[model samples]
Target: MSFSLSTTVVSPEGEQLYTFEYAALVTQTSIALVQVYVELGVIEAIGSMLHPREIARIAQIQRLRQDLGLNLAGAAMVLDMAAEIAQLRAQLKAHQSRPQNELF
Candidate 1:
């Protein structure tokens, strides 16, 4: 049950799962808001369990909405774009790290 910035609780099977209520608590938001996010497909849940990453995503969404004055859909789209950019950057880095073939 560590609340460290980089720590998340995991089960014996190495799966990290938390209830919707716990996710709301962790994000300092309301359970109704959590439910709205789920209903809006902003954050997904498996049954009543949510991955820690989803909780973090919820916090990010809230920050974007409150701090940046973005709407929910805009926030979600921004997050999706950010994730895509990160993935593309990682791929570009990996390609740059590979050895070039001799052309001459």
Candidate 2:
């Protein structure tokens, strides 16, 4: 019997972290690109590992760059704006949910 080794890393909180090499593989990009993304702040990494949420951000950036023909910086900017808008919408919803007495 043989056991296969896995390279995946998990935090105590159960969040998955990926190395640059593994993230590149998972994201279907090259290691160089991943490193560059990290350098350019397109993707934020905690040292050499990236959180699962960051993986989704990488995918979103890729989608924006590929589909909209935007550059990495532009893609990152768009995503940031989208996140801010989402946060504002959630805040608005929560505020609206409060009773009229709280609106003052």
Candidate 3:
């Protein structure tokens, strides 16, 4: 969860710029891989709401709007999508943890 960024500048003529050397402390914690899988599933659900081209366009529009002090209706759409994503994630986790051989 923690990260660091480092930049190295070489010669101005050569113009070599290096940024973000990340290193995390390796810990052998007993974290469940299923939890990681569930998190990734939630992320994928959110990601699927936007096409690649729409993502690019949204990024550009957000940047331009921020620079020019403009507002749009995307916030509502994002909120709705977030709600749906949360519901789906909860259902997925519940289903994953359910007992398979329950008697009726």
Candidate 4:
């Protein structure tokens, strides 16, 4: 439920990462729901931890599913397409900022 710029958590195994419990709190969902999102490929886990962005995406997916009444597949497709469009926009912006001659 709280957000921090850089919060580090130490696991009993001595690894530094965000716990699934924290991710669930941050996403305002349950651990099992987060796992379901991971299993469905609606979000990804880096090793065994979810990135902050992935957590946010999971929240977005939850909203799409609950508020908009989108099915799991539909929400996944929307998220995927949104990611692709964001990448394409970034590439276009980078290309636009380059020299005209370099575009050839």
Best by lDDT: 1
Give lDDT per model, in order: 0.85, 0.83, 0.38, 0.78
Q: Which candidate do you rate higher for lDDT, 1 or 2? A: 1
Write model 1 residue lDDT over 1-104, tens digit each, in one string: 33335334566678988877788777999889999999999998877678888999999998999999999999999999999999999998888887787322
How would you encode candidate 4's per-residue C-alpha lDDT over 1-104 as one tens digit per residue? Answer: 55455545555677566656677887688888888877877787766676667777878888899999999889889998998999999999998999999888
Q: TM-score, each model?
A: 0.82, 0.85, 0.31, 0.74
Off by over 4 Å in 4: 1-16
Candidate 2 C-alpha error for residue 83, in Å = 0.5
Runs in model 3 deviating more than 4 A are 1-71
Candidate 1, clashing residue pairs?
A: none
Q: Report clashes for each candidate as comma-separated counts.
A: 0, 0, 0, 0
* Arranged by TM-score, best first: 2, 1, 4, 3
Q: Which residues of candidate 2, in runs, are more than 4 Å off?
A: 1-4
List of clashing residue pairs for candidate 3: none
- lDDT for model 3, please: 0.38
Query: Can you write out model 2's per-residue Cα lDDT over 4-104, one digit (the tens) per residue?
Result: 24546787788887777777777777778888888988888987888877878888888898999999889999999999999999999999999999789
Task: Tell me the lDDT of model 2 at 24.
Answer: 71
Error of 1 at 13 (Å): 5.8
The candidate, 1 or 3, that scores higher on lDDT is 1
All-Cα superposition RMSD per candidate: 5.1, 3.6, 17.9, 5.2
